[model samples]
Target: MSRVVWGACLLVASTAFVACADSGQTAAVARLASGEVAVSGTPEGIPAHAPARFEFGTEASATRVAMWDIDVRPDGEGLPPGSGSVAQGREVYNVYCVACHGPTGMEGPNDRLVDSEQWDDVPSTRTVGNYWPHATTLYDYIRKAMPQLTPGILSDDQVYAVIAYILWMNEIVPEDTVLDAETLPAVVMPARDKFVVDDRVGGTGPVR
Candidate 1:
């Protein structure tokens, strides 16, 4: 064949080969300009080793869900029916909290929980009395995760008592004060006014 004829034949053969190679493969997913995802594929497109149906464990039971849904709001929404006095709290703290939070919640091997002094914006100096904006949050946090070594082990009354002791140490409540669902949320935090609402909509201006 002539050189020109031979080159044309080679180009045609290459184009045909590419078309044949691409015929077996299909685009599984694609994104359109309008930000919508387009999917196109058959079961045959999946690998043979893939399972016919996936078993992602059993569905969670209502009782199991209720166990983990123990979040308490600032308004005492989820506070359980229990009470704790400062004296009772002291006992609970001595047994479970003293090791981590120190004897008086000041000499901590961990974060200090009882400082009524002014916070100098230093993170290390921030404590429950000086920095925390909500007293209920303290109860919520401790009940959810506390004692460091064994979290969620304290009973509701014990949790309340321990919180009372810490608050007493912080001078937020009187030594004889008893905290329960009604009284706990009513306890005002000292730093409550320090925090403001972040009303910035969408990714607008600087973070509040």
Candidate 2:
């Protein structure tokens, strides 16, 4: 019995059938051995088989894994041990955050994060003060990604401080309030009730 195997060759797409001629046609063969089957010319090498194993990259190190796994949950599960006041947060915000977000959270070159209560009466842009439902999410987001130019550079206390400043500007917290793991999650945003629960039934169960 004879076995047929398609060679890894460039396939030609044509509608009409053309017979092999001496002009310029080359036939691709799966197996090529000395003094064996010859098409336009004699075979060059032996049969090529698929590779059994493939080697690409190395395993990730523990340090690298820890760096990427830095997400904080809504329940303040991953919060670090640190605290900051609104005053301290304002200083950090003026120094690092003001360049993009402007002097106050309302005066923004980017999205406004404060003075957004007017949105309740009129159709306005969604700022953190009016749209966000949780305070802990703010701390998590800023700590993971902020300072746009240089993210993940701020210390835990600095992250808490900057978050406090934003919250104070939004009127969600007192100016003298300090933000930490315990206090951050306890903050209830004004729009919390406005957001409806996700009750969509997925293929498996309820998405909620």
Candidate 3:
């Protein structure tokens, strides 16, 4: 064959091969709009049967799962079916809270937020009896999230029991009383009316 004809034949074959290769590529594989290689079916390497959504799966199990994690709120929401007395609370306090909060509920290693003394110059002054506006905050902070190292470990009954004990020690409630949502909210902490509204904006200003 002539050299020119041979070169032309080779060029035609290469062009045809390139065209065939280009035709095989996917059209919507990687679109300009999405910037994703949109998968019409199951994505590469992912099994079709696998969950694309969250599921432990099935209706009965789903209800159980939801019920398992029901949240109890601060206003007597997740209060378990239990009751506690100041007597019981004293026992709980001795075991769980006393070392740091003290048996008398005074400030110990931790900030005593129950019945701590009032001093005009004393910094870090807050006790459950003297400072907390609502006793439910004590139950909520303790039960939902205390002990400094561990929180939310106490049962509802135990938390109420401890709170009752703290109140007794603080002198707001009698030693024989039981604490619950109804009674706790009504206890009327000494500082409840004493605390003035704070409306301040910056550094080293007068407190109202």
For each of the candidates, give the backbone clash count. 0, 0, 7
Q: What is the lDDT of residue 181 in candidate 3?
A: 61
Tens-place lDDT per residue, model 1, 1-208, is 2578556655655564454344432222111212255354446567868776577699888788777778876667668998999999999999998988899899989988888886545545689988898789978899988977899899999989988889999999999999999999899898875564333455766874
Q: Per-residue CA lDDT of candidate 2, range 1-208, in tens?
A: 0122112111211211122222223332112211245454323552346343345678788788767767665556567889998999988998889988888877788877786474556437677788887788887788777888898888899988888889888888898899998888788887765654333545886564
Regarding TM-score, does 1 or 2 come out ahead? Answer: 1
Q: Which ten residues in a row have the lowest lDDT in candidate 3?
A: 25-34
Cα distance off (Å), candidate 2, residue 10: 56
lDDT, candidate 2, residue 85? 89
| RMSD of candidates 1 onward, in order | 21.9, 21.4, 25.5
The residue pairs found clashing in candidate 2 are: none
Give per-model TM-scores.
0.64, 0.62, 0.55
Which 10-residue window of candidate 2 scores lowest in summed lDDT? Answer: 8-17
What is the C-alpha local distance difference test score of each model?
0.78, 0.70, 0.65
Off by over 4 Å in 3: 1-80, 113-124, 201-208
Itemize residue pairs with steric clashes in candidate 1: none
Residue 70 in candidate 3 has what lDDT? Answer: 38
Instruction: Estimate candidate 3's alpha-carbon lDDT, on a 0 to 1 scale.
Output: 0.65
